[model samples]
Target: MQRSRDGRCKCLSKVGLSWKGSVDEDVVELVQPLTGREQFFTASSCAGCIILLDGGINGFEVQKQNRCWLLVTHKLYVKDDVIVALKKANGGAVLKFEPLVLHVQRQQLQDAQILHSVAIDSAFRNSGIIVGKRGKTVLAVQSTHGLEVPLSHKGKLMVTEEYTDFLLKISKSKNGGKQEEN
Candidate 1:
């Protein structure tokens, strides 16, 4: 399953993928659980748009009739119907989906306002998430192993020098056998 930029929950259904409000979304009628491949991916139709979920990939590609389209990189273990979890990189957790679907739109492909990014955390290197948004800024989650560094997008788009010192202090404290928030 996938969570849209507006926090809506999306899942596959008999008719296709369906979206409901954030907390009330359900995939009971949308997806059938099966074995084989165990990963999920979701993305829109664009040149570099790709969401690598679970152990599979889902996104869009060009077709004869459609200028831009969504496509899945089929794996040998993949089956027709299955439910999988969608993982995001950068220390975020996974989002579950029953079945995955690809959606395409001409405007989505040509729009330059779209933001596509892939985040992979050092702790969860094996798991990653791809996000697509029109005008949303991605927030970095609090790091359990390192200091909480704040990144600003405005101005020079750089982290404060004090943040680096804070990280060093945190590291030193850890090595000195003390527990403190760096």
Candidate 2:
């Protein structure tokens, strides 16, 4: 069962289904080292991302069901890019930044716990372990570093373009996509 789960993850990655199509460049280095380790394999990962979402009444906490991706990228962006993207917001437009996130499958529960503990200790406050019914364990490394800024209301830009530029720069610096010490 353990071997099959590991194989399943590898096959998914090879078939380009994990990231919807091919691996994300943002997390290549972060997960590359684990590829050779027989006991660990990545299920999915995204180092960071900046997304312009067309959300509705819920405001910043955009629901997955109703939100639309107006603009999305896993790479750092400049002010002008965001400014241009903001022009298309229909309603409750939200600009959000999400930090590194990784799901790793391990051979044993202890391995998952160790990785989860290290991730949590290293400022990945949302890190945790998942125990599957098949006795497969997965370590989810996630962070609390995320930002959401509402760009418009009712299809009209709410803030000046200059402010939008500043916010974009802030989002860029807050990406935290660089390789970590671990």
Q: What is the C-alpha lDDT of each candidate?
A: 0.24, 0.73
Candidate 1: stretches off by over 4 Å: 1-145, 154-159, 177-182
Cα lDDT, model 2, residue 121: 86
For each candidate in turn, give its C-alpha RMSD to the true structure in angstroms.
19.8, 4.8
The backbone clash count of each candidate, in order, is 15, 0
What is the per-residue lDDT of model 1 for residues 1-182, given as tens digits with 9 covering 90 to 100?
34456544332321232132111123222222210112222222111112122211123221223211122222211212111211112221111211222231112332211211221332312222223576222222111232222222211213334543344344434323353453
Candidate 2 local lDDT, 1-63, one digit each (tens):
134554534522453325546556767777777655677877777777888888685625666
User: Measured by TM-score, how close is model 2 to the native structure?
Assistant: 0.82
lDDT of 1 at 162: 52
Which segments of model 2 are wrong by more than 4 Å?
1-17, 177-182
lDDT of model 1, residue 180: 46
